[model samples]
Target: MRMHTRIVPLAMTTALLAGGTAAMATGAAGAAEPKGDVTAQSCYGSARNYTGTPGGPGRNAHWPATGTYAYATRNCTDINLKVNYTRDVRVCFKNTGQCNGWKKAKKGVWKVAASNVRDGAGFYIQFKGANRSTGKIAY
Candidate 1:
């Protein structure tokens, strides 16, 4: 009788553990998608608003200056850039060697900048000239 009781309890415990693990897996699979907008300003105080689907592509206003920049709101999974003038631009993870290529800027459109970036990486803009540009940025 003693051995029987011990085995029943052990089996019950195993079942409970298996159930808990399955629940955890389901929760992770249904994890919520990112929401809301992220905005970043230029070194010269130009506001670039990313008003797109959270964790998706979007647009912004004109920005000026050339330097490394990041969003102040939340972490992003990827990033891209576009401009109103012809120039070279790239986005990079802050403080890391991971970066996109120096693609030529498109006029008032969105272009692929970087992918698989660190969750909260910054960007590097290479303004060939003019020092100012307007367009969209996906994040």
Candidate 2:
């Protein structure tokens, strides 16, 4: 009888943990869709912005510059995984001619995608941009 009491609670706890894991998995699986294409937002307010003037290829005082910024589109549409952007930003830039083929033509500009997770609502990313000739993310 004593064994039965111990087993009952153990079984219950195991069941709960299992259920929680399943719930999380379900959430992650839900966001596995193609997600179409990831996009980067133009420079704007905040220190990350670099659309004002042009800077040479070498690093600058600004944190994130504009140019051929490359990053993977990351979406945390799942319930289990928390957005791990604190370390490194991961995302595929939603390429647009608006930046004028900084990616397709390989203008030589390099940009890193911010790990900012999208709420699956109105999410936008910001990457590097260049003057097309210099291949630097000065703007």
Candidate 3:
């Protein structure tokens, strides 16, 4: 009957569409890696957040200047920082057990721990030495 004929074409079309959609999703999952600046904001939003530059040759983590709390202008070239507090935060890195207070820090890459920042305080890279606070960043 006419109804049966129409049903077959509709069913075939639906099946084909579904198959194509599934294939496309699978392909997307295996696409190229992500690029650009990486950022992590607080649950309450930008009030407390951090951003880092893309990894490359001799490139270290850098923070923005102003807008938010805290500041630092240092490129962490060969070190990683795990910050558990903000504004005089305690830092721990490779080869160093207890780094000096934020004020007397050095220029290098830091991987700030979001959950570690205390009491809703914002994260900021601390640039040490003479030219302190080249910049700061907020997520």
Best by TM-score: 1
Give the Cα error of residue 19 in candidate 1, in Å: 41
Give the C-alpha miss distance for residue 66 in model 1, angstroms. 6.5
What TM-score, computed on C-alpha atoms, does each candidate reach?
Answer: 0.42, 0.26, 0.32
- Candidate 1, residue 101: the lDDT equals 61
Ranking according to lDDT, highest score first: 1, 3, 2
Runs with alpha carbons beyond 4 Å of true place in candidate 3: 1-7, 20-115, 121-126
lDDT of 2 by residue, 4-56 (tens): 99999999999999999999899889876445433322221111222322335
lDDT of 3 by residue, 32-125 (tens): 4334332332221233334433223443233434333442222221223423232233233223233435432333424442323333333434
Query: For candidate 3, what is the TM-score?
Result: 0.32
Q: What lDDT score belongs to each candidate, Candidate 1 first? A: 0.52, 0.33, 0.39
Candidate 1 Cα RMSD after full superposition onto the native fold (Å): 11.7
Q: Sort by TM-score, best first.
A: 1, 3, 2
Candidate closer to the true structure by lDDT (higher is better), 1 or 3 = 1
Model 2 misplacement above 4 A: 31-139
lDDT of 2 at 35: 54
Model 3, position 17, has a per-residue lDDT of 95
Model 3, poorest ten-residue lDDT window? 71-80
Q: Mind giving the per-residue lDDT tens digits that candidate 1 earns over 13-112?
A: 9999999999998888767433333232221123254321111123322232234365522333445565656557665455775655677767775565
Cα displacement (Å) at residue 38, model 2: 4.7
Measured with C-alpha atoms, the lDDT of residue 29 in candidate 3 is 78
